[model samples]
Target: MKQPNPERTPILLGQIDTDNHIATTVSLFVILLVVHRIGISVYRLYFHPLRKFPGPRYLAATELPYLYRNHLKGDWVRDMVGLHRKYGPVVRIAPNRLALDGSIGWPQVFAHRGANQDEYAKVRGFLFPGDHEAIIAAPRDVHRRQRRQLAHAFSDGALIEHEPLICHYVSLLVQQLAKRAENNELIDIVKWLNFTTFDIIGDLTFGESFHSLDNSEYHPWVLTIFETIKGSAMGRFFAAYPIVRPLVVLSMGADRIKKLQEHQIFSKEKARARMAAGAEPGRRDFMTYMLRDTRSGEKGLTTNEIEMNSPILITAGSETTATALSGFFFYLVQTPSAYDYLTKEIRSAFRNEDEINLRSTSSLQYLQGCIEETLRCYPPSAETPPRVSPGGEIDGRYVSSGTILSVYQWSTFRNPQNFRDPDSFRPERWLPTSHPLHDVRFDNDNRSAFKPFSAGTRDCIGKKLAYSEMRLIISRILFRFDYEIAESQDDWHTSQLVFVIWDKGPLKIKLKPRTMTE
Candidate 1:
């Protein structure tokens, strides 16, 4: 400061002035950003195209409301039900999204995928990373192509060949449950069902069994699948705010990302191996169709398609089936009379465990009714599968192109308008009108609204397989052992947190072998 050089004085002052200007610029920019955000929010609330839509003021303005209800609280399904109850079928869930219910929503959004009509495509956000390449995520045309190649494998005829694989694993499950019964043990039916279904899909898709039932422990990859889904469910929260994607990924932490990467790598390796093996002529598995795809011309799946879709198959095949079985058993143990009726139906229908097969089990009417009721009560898709409206009318309202529409399965299934006494476990509703057991009161419920597997072209591909697996596993267990809700788990259904799928808690049940000799 003493005797500062004359030449340096101007430079120092210039530096100070530049720093002040930068500070002022940054402050002004931040203020502008705040103002812009406030303005946009106001517009969204009162002046956006979706302004007239019925919804909470906060949700209509920002995603924060739905995120708070779904991601933060884990009561998203319940919250949606409440919302629809308050706001009617068409409620604006976000600034650009509407959740629809009733008969028209299904046919219009999911079913109307013709060249001449509005094809509300799959919401890309709901699917995996592969965009149109992933089967569940694939666009309409890509889905049609991919589905063509894979359709053979999931076909009723193909599943007949795959039945041996299912039966083989279900046999192992029976053996394990029989062991548990002998020990008079309290077993988590959900965990065991997961093990069975995972093993079957592992074998069917990957061309090898996870051997989880054989080992009595989940495969490391299976554990990874569960972890990945949890992360994905959480990731969906941040996905609602696309601007924060990178920040959300960073916040999800490195360990989670690494784990998800591991899952992908693991799946890739299995799929690659299966592809290398090629189809074994008559081998009837998921890989077989893809392996022979080149010969199928237009219907063939590419190597990349096969690799990505195998995991999707495993997930769609295994998780949903296990959820249905677990949910059925959960309701079964709670409703004593329904439980008694179903047990009688299954045991009486089959003389022995060996007598039950895919074809034979279909005749068990009461068992089928129970399965239907379970699907209605606790569907595999606990949340809505969001669809997009590409500028068309839906539920009597014209929606702009890219407007999101979702008919939440949980709310639609449970809505009083859809079903009478929707909360109660009543299998009688599913019984045919010709059946003496059928109820007119139950019949009065809008039967058309109960679409657990969903509807239209995008409906579940593995539906038949799912039904077969559920029927076989449930029938086997009921025949061999009598089960009751374990004392520790009360109100387990309400306690479950809904992710995209259910983060199902253990369904603890106490099993006792039926008196075979008596």
Candidate 2:
């Protein structure tokens, strides 16, 4: 510093050169990466296997749009409808995914495997990221074994025995709502419906009730299940880029991961307890059938398998039934004539509250029609159930191997091609005979396109049980109380966040006890 040492000049210049070289190299590398990404995107848009399919440019080029719309915005179902409307029945939702809205694609993709036809299995991305493969999302071979064991638990005979237990819970709901009505409370009917269904499923599956209805709050495990779903929905956005998924999961922090692990541990312990104790001799629960061997003495599921499938059974059985019930009531209340008609149907059919049971409610045509219309209008699974082609043709379209094929349920159900005035609630469309308002448009609508439970081997196994729960709960509620919308919910169905299951908002309804007078 005193004299600017001449000896140090070369060293300083050399250091500067070295730093410049390093910076240049890094900049070059970044440039190459950006160039490569752009090249890939262009290829996807113009030369990829799905390039011929119609879709928005951004969605067809990269999955970022999908991630943004589905995970971040939580309105992918509505987005699907818009895409189908703009681009016709088949649209490229991703670089490799095709969403089908046409009627033929449903059976072609979801139908049972045949001798001449190729097999289509569930997409691997549907599986829970960190757990034993649950039966609902398992691969074909694993699913076959798991379904065989669990089928007995959900069998007609099993449901018959479970019916009494179901009735007991429905009775509790009726009593609870009556109390709420007496108190002049504005209740969240959706929450109560969820509590009722969850309690019944919890008792049946875990050998005890969650007591959500009794406690007037969600059980910790049920809350955990829903949080898990939200986390999962976010995780799926990264699933398209499998390489980054592990890092994304790790970044979710220790607290969330620990909570998820704790829930799994709790579920496993409960399942083990049920297996050890066995079911009551005359009255069977879910565990009883799961533990019992098939007629051929085929082995049942492993402890881990039963533990994994238990959560699925509980969530599927409870959440879906609750969604249908809440959605049905939402529409029923808005359509005063339909609501009056349905209430009359229920009240006239039941001589007393005790007389209402699954068997007795089965014959109510208007009740069934209301259920169907609700399912059509607000399906619990509003998004497409993606299927992967083993390699073959789907409705005359030759899709490349491993291409994702999905039928957008929301779009198809709402399509004018499937139902006339589809947005308007019309339960009469389900009646066997022509609706009095029928026209050529109504006659031509493809009713077969409305498959709420899906179809074939992968269809919802809990279909019959779901119907039973819906019928019993709705009838019992209508018979005991009359409800009015406590507040208006504009676009209730459209606003719901669907992440595997609907994250529903409160359906606030003011209830009044049904009075007998002319």
The clash count of every prediction, one per candidate, is: 0, 0
Best by lDDT: 1
What C-alpha lDDT does candidate 2 achieve relative to the native structure? 0.80
> Least accurate stretch of 10 residues (summed lDDT) in model 1?
291-300
Instruction: Write one digit per residue (lDDT tens) for candidate 2, span 1-518.
Output: 37877899999999999999999999999999999999999999988877887888988878887775776457777767777878887888888888887486677777777767667777764635533377777877788788877888778888898988999999988888888899999989988998899999999887789999889889888877766666666657766666766675676554554566666777777788888886453467788777777678875777777888887888788888899999998898888878888888889887888888999999988889889989988888876557887777665667888898878677888887678898988877776554443335455668878888887787888999999999998988888888888655856766787765577998888898977641
Off by over 4 Å in 1: 1-27, 68-73, 240-253, 294-299
Tens digit of per-residue lDDT, candidate 1, span 336-446: 989888888877777788998998998888889999999988998876568777898766777889887878888888899889999899999888888778888976788
C-alpha TM-score for every candidate: 0.92, 0.93
lDDT over C-alpha atoms for residue 207 of model 2: 74
Candidate 2 weakest ten by summed lDDT: 432-441
Error of 2 at 498 (Å): 1.9
Model 1 vs. true fold: TM: 0.92
What does each candidate score in C-alpha RMSD?
2.8, 2.5
